[model samples]
Target: MTKRELIDNIARDGLVERLVANVCHRRHRSLPDLVQMVYEVLLNYDEEKLMRIHRRGAINFFIVRIIENLYFSRTSPYYRQIRRFAQHSDILKDE
Candidate 1:
């Protein structure tokens, strides 16, 4: 499938959203941003690679890893861009 087609399939199936929800769990506020970020990352991959992943039935595992890394890795862009700010806001609210 083409890149756009693969992306459409994934989005239409709500795979990214479901994986983000599963990864974020109680962090509901981060769901939308995380899902968007995951899509952005996925878009960086070429159509051939995405198709290979789909053929191997590794799409879910690959996306789950992306979500986990984006959410939990301190050096990830998501951490720097969203989670860090979120943590600071929570701290300020508590203070």
Candidate 2:
């Protein structure tokens, strides 16, 4: 599938809303930002990897995995920072 098709499929499947709701309840509360981040991840996905994945017949699963990895990756310093920031903001709100 093309990139646009991939994004459309994801959104049409309600994965974006589900992801945002999940993360929001779990401490990452920025719904719009998370949606944008998901889109960014999709837009920047490697074409070769996508082709290989498309051949495998479970593209939505792969897409969800990619987004979940970016959102909650323990080893990714950038995602760690985002999680930390979200936690700190939550703490502030509780103050």
Number of clashing pairs per prediction, in order:
0, 0
| lDDT digits (tens) for residues 1-95 of candidate 1 | 78788889999999899888877886758778888989998999777888899889999999999999999999999999989999999999998
Cα-based TM-score, every candidate: 0.91, 0.62
lDDT of 2 by residue, 38-63 (tens): 77777788877776777787765775
CA-lDDT, candidates in order: 0.88, 0.68
The alpha-carbon deviation from the true structure for residue 14 of candidate 2, after best TM-score superposition, in angstroms, is: 3.2
Q: What's the residue-level lDDT of 17 in candidate 1? A: 91
| Model 1 weakest 10-residue run by lDDT | 22-31
- Provide the lowest-lDDT 10-residue window in model 2: 23-32
Candidate 1 to native Cα RMSD, angstroms: 1.2
- For model 1, the stretches where C-alpha displacement exceeds 4 angstroms are none
